[model samples]
Target: MPPRRCTASAAAGQTGSDSDLDEFIMRCLSCEEQYDMDDAGTCRECYQEANEAEEELRLEIDDLKSKVSFLTLSSPTLNPSTADIVLVPVDDSDAAPIPAHKHVLSCRSPVFNAMLENDMEERRSGTIKISDVSHDTLCAFVNYLYTAEASLDNQMACNLLVLGEKYQVKHLKTYCEKYLIAKMNWNKAIANYAFAYQYNCKQLRSASLAVILDKMDLFTQNEYYAELVDTNPRLVVEIYETYIGKQLNTAGTL
Candidate 1:
């Protein structure tokens, strides 16, 4: 047989068509056998094994997500054994900053029992002196004690805020103040105004005043002066005098 001719064109990378991949696979110097480029690029056996490993990892990830969701919804008291716990590492910076708690203490809370007994006794006597807050309020309070996370919703916070103030839970009171201050819209302001005023929440009152003042023109123009007068006549008078009357006074002075 004649020696096969090898040309510069072949060396300069002209891929022949049995599928370009096949030509490359056949050109491999290691194994003298020609094979499809797709086959040459990957060992089918190894590719299948890698695919199986990826699928297993995906399933493990999905299982972990499901477990996390289950743990989140399961109440600690109801399913104590099924709780998922995670340990977080404290860095040097985190270790260095020791938070100064104004009033953090470990003590048994008798407020719950006392309120319950008082409510029950009132109910039996037919007086019903205590309207009685709900179990959810108590649960939220207890949870706050353990986790210190103020996850109480607005209505729950309103219920608990009264309790916190009554029980002298200064921490809870402060927490309510901070959250309510951030959420000091007109409705909540009106709802909690008496409580805010009674509890001496000066900041809450001030926040409410600021909102009223900012929208004074709108209130006056829209004839909703009732909301203002209802909250504080003195405050309403102040707004009218400062914003409305003052402008009138300024015009007169001019």
Candidate 2:
């Protein structure tokens, strides 16, 4: 094939003019879209380098995922007979105890490690009673300790996050925080902000506060807003303080 030319005719329906023909057009190697000089993105060399970097990152992610799969234990629910210890939700007597491995629980949570490793009643009875948690939440918590996975809805995420913080399971706490942050919006913002404050989840608290600041007028009208003020007046005051600080920063910037 003859060497490709940057002719004006190359652009559909455009007649060639000396200036237009002289202007170069190239296909973007990244997006694979054609572009004229003015619309160009990266140089060919940079595009090629970017492609290499992306491939390397993809490979690294795949490697990390594979390692996670290899390290993750099978859910104790699948084979309760093999579990050495059981977790009972104190509030739900009728609920069956959740089966789990002591080693897995110990490895995941320092609280569990101390409870089981030391001369504790939990170790002797082979049963650990978890208070202020539902049977389903206990089951999910134990499953996550083993498999590092959970089927989370908003409520479940909140439940698990509370348990995660109580147990000092940092990874699970971070996971639940990210989920809540991603699901944050105007409707849930106040409630989530209150929950984050109660739980000491700074990241989720900041994100929820940002949402609340954006819709301050509507926030007071939210059903949860009054309940939060009644339940935790201190937290409500903090929200106002944050909003005021943000306004001050904006005024300074302007």
Instruction: Give one digit per residue, the lDDT tens place, for model 1 in 121-153.
Output: 422432212235454555565456445555767
Cα lDDT tens digits, model 2, 1-254, are 22235654566565677755544656666566666778867666887798899999999999999999999888888988988999999999999998888999999999999999999999999999999999989989988888888999999999999999999999999999999999998899989988998899999999998888898978789888999989998988988898899889999999
User: What lDDT does each candidate get?
Assistant: 0.53, 0.88
lDDT of 1 at 85: 25
Model 2 TM-score on a 0 to 1 scale = 0.89
State the local distance difference test value for candidate 2: 0.88
TM-score of each: 0.41, 0.89
Among the numbered candidates, top TM-score falls to 2
The regions of model 2 sitting more than 4 angstroms off are 1-22
Question: Candidate 2, residue 102: CA error in Å?
Answer: 1.0
What is candidate 1's CA lDDT for residue 222? 36
Q: Where's the lowest-lDDT run of ten residues in candidate 2?
A: 1-10
As for candidate 2, its clashing pairs are none
Could you tell me how far off, in angstroms, the CA of residue 185 lies in candidate 2 after the best superposition?
1.6
